[model samples]
Target: MSEHLASIFGTEKDRVNCPFYFKIGASRPDIITPGLDSLGNPIPPKQLQQHFGDLYEDLFEELSKYGEIESLNICDNLADHMVGNVYVQFSEEEHASNAFKNLTGRFYAGRPIIVDFSPVKDFREATCRQYEENICNRGRYCNFMHLKKIGRDLRRHLFGRYRRSYRSRSRSRSRSPYRHKS
Candidate 1:
């Protein structure tokens, strides 16, 4: 994953012209519910899925300002090292680049977000075994996203306004601020 991210975002000296997708790390200890386990250790993965869902919605709305998003997958599984990871795929490389540039190092939920280009080209390839069977024993430890379809009506409405505002902003930027002296 690091290698793929480097290829897309490039090194300090060189950068890629366009990247297809990017991932955001918004995981934080605070996101988990405050509670202790049987051993008196702080139990993680406690109702954080709901928190992640809210984060996803906020991110989707904000990132849409840059461009059209093809897919947004938030990893709900705490198993493995992928918990609290979000992968966003954009229709264009420019959009991905913009999102990467803007979101990297930004704080979310009181934690700094880690943003990087993702090597994943297809989401279906990363499906969880337990999710498909509906018997995920790991529960929160499962390392795959269990997603429900976002309403198309909401998406359409949001994107429509975004496009209009984006166009207007571009137009305004292109116009000259100074007027010819009469």
Candidate 2:
């Protein structure tokens, strides 16, 4: 192996670290946990967006502690593997590794956190194009990531700071952490 490669990947041949890692958190169907409202009732459609916003904020605040997050995404796809998957892209590989190590023992929303290095080099490939245009024929069951939509105000609050730094980087990765808008 080249010296540069050796230094980057480290001597441990078992694990390889990268700038991106995704956490499989409490996967839900269509971004709602259902019966999340008071008295265990289903959240009203009117308040569903608020509940999702709350979730998005909580995740960003918790995950940002590990590093400077470049992007964070939650998959809205209903497929078993893609559902409610939280993908975090850090500015550096070390940050991603730190998060993986630190988050392993932690729990979120009463569920154990599952963190791992991502093989996904491109979100575009995994993204459902139809969903972007709001014309997804497959709905929630699509194999591609159907990312949830977040309120514009909340998005600015969460990602505005990152945007300035991200502009200097690749535009391919500007999108981060939003909720599924119905």
Candidate 3:
């Protein structure tokens, strides 16, 4: 069962590019990746996949410096509005804002990383139910967040580091943390 789930959603060693991290980062603030420019890249297919994994891991580690991440999601939707979107949810609103500010004009894969505040608060409420069941006629074009899954190893490392303090941080509520993390 675990293997099946792992195949469906990559494991840490796999480190495939996940769309849900965009949403996790999105709930805190929407970071839309207008373009990855993967089409023009000269790298081989296998190497390209490795690059993507590195990018996802790199992104998670980079965001960690600003604050504790509650969630990190990326969107796999092909829709213009949802493509290549990465969301990082920091434990605190300030951290989100901080990340948003710093990331506003950065470049990834020779493209600009456009970061902004997303209205999404709860991911459960924002996901497409039909999509989850694999009955969505819309497929990858669904407007709702079709969160991509992360690898267990990467997921464990990204999430496990902060397990001890998650409770203490959540108790102190601040303004809606739905904004671009600077």
Best by lDDT: 2
Sorted on lDDT, highest at the top, how do the candidates line up? 2, 3, 1
What does candidate 3's lDDT look like per residue over 1-182, in tens digits?
88866775742223234454344333223434332554644666566556656777888999998898888877767765667878778889999999999988998767788888765678877688888888889987777778777668877877887874655455433444654343
Candidate 1 ranges beyond 4 A from true positions: 1-53, 147-182
Candidate 2: worst 10 consecutive residues by lDDT? 19-28
Model 2: CA > 4 A from native: 1-42, 163-182
Error in Å for residue 33 of model 2: 6.4
11-92 per-residue lDDT for model 2 (tens digits): 3222344322222222223343342565777677668777778988898888888878877788776665566588888888
**Best of the candidates, TM-score:** 2
RMSD of each: 10.0, 12.6, 15.1
- Residue 163, model 2, lDDT: 78
Cand. 1 Cα-lDDT: 0.62
Q: Give the backbone clash total of model 2.
A: 5
